[model samples]
Target: MKDGKRFPVVEENYRFECTLCGNCCTGDQRVWLNPADLMRMALFLGYGHTSELFRQNVVLLDEGENGAWRPRILFKSYKKLRFCPFLENHLDDRGRITGLCRLHPKYKPLICRLAPLGRVWDAETGSEQWLFVKPAPDCPGVNSSRLNSLRETLQQYGSEIEEETAFLKKLQHFLEMKSEPEAYQELFYFIVKRKGEGDKR
Candidate 1:
């Protein structure tokens, strides 16, 4: 095979113009939700600024320590497939995939908001690598000639860089708390409650 390794996530840059075909939102992929995402989505869905309702009904917390990161809060993939529950399929006369993600910019999760672009985090160095990937094999966004700045494009998406940084700081503090096993569950609830408190105000 030819050496088509492409570039590192950080150096990756490509043109993309999302057609909102919903292909990316449909599949067995992980949609990780951070505190910010939870809070924003709750508020968007009129959950009264607190994620309690949303958490109870919409999200799942992955506490397994088997991966690079520990204690992840994520959206419940629709049914058994990776289809996002929030994805709304638009159809034409005969009914076919036309558009998706009904809650696009406003209530979209952080991951969904950053679709077609990929990111990798370095825990040790506290750095992130960026990659511009095709949202799907048939995604027309990747083939467009229009070019966009990664930084600028992120800004256009209403990037949560600042909030993500703050969340990491909170995560650090939570890690430092290092609760005993008996209290770990409580700690999770506490974090959730605390994270949503700000939006309550």
Candidate 2:
């Protein structure tokens, strides 16, 4: 459960496919980057270290336990609107301007890859609860008639989702063991290595 409510997994009654309207890429939504996200994005961008990516494009928020660093993608302002830095616009076949993700095909942040789906971690149970978060009032993706089963859609990125979740669990464990904010902060800000957390994959 998140925000005091349990989100049910997507059901057969629901249908969704991104229309590329770019609505989900904008507004006040936050594109949180987990450790895996930081690592992959840095590698994709040819950065030598996750800290370098943080220095250039990502912002570490002081929103985690004991103010442990939480990484988030930086937004770019265009035409008085704020959007993900990776958001790009192009003319569709009908000449309408539509949005595209620059990191797509590979390297999109897990949150962006989830699209119409969402998941919440229940630490007490150490399990994930999946749910629908799209067909958002402003998004037309849910109206698409050509849609895949929720199971299939999710399976397409199952491995990646699991890997990120594992890393998150590790992070939570670290926070619980470390009492000093600075101790955890360096793990994200300056260190390119994962300490004793295993390979940097």
lDDT (Cα atoms) of all candidates against the true structure:
0.58, 0.70
Model 2 weakest lDDT span, ten residues long: 186-195
- All candidates' TM-scores? 0.67, 0.79
Q: Please, what are the lDDT tens digits per residue for candidate 1 over residues 76-137?
A: 55457666667777776767667677566776777666766766555457777676656666
lDDT (10s digit) by residue, model 2, range 1-201: 344564446555356778888888887677777776776677677765777875685555556533435778877777888888778899999999898988885777888777667776776698766677872458888777866676776688888877877767766776677655455555565334433655554
Q: Among all windows of ten consecutive residues in candidate 1, which has the lowest summed lDDT? A: 64-73
Name the lDDT value of residue 75 in candidate 2. Answer: 79
For model 2 the local lDDT of residue 165 reads 72
Clashes of each: 1, 0
TM-score, predicted candidate 2 vs. hidden true structure: 0.79
| Cα shift from native, residue 124, model 2 (Å) | 1.4
Tell me how far the alpha carbon of residue 41 in candidate 2 is from the true structure, in angstroms, after superposition: 1.4
lDDT measured at residue 53 in model 1 versus the true structure, 0 to 100: 40
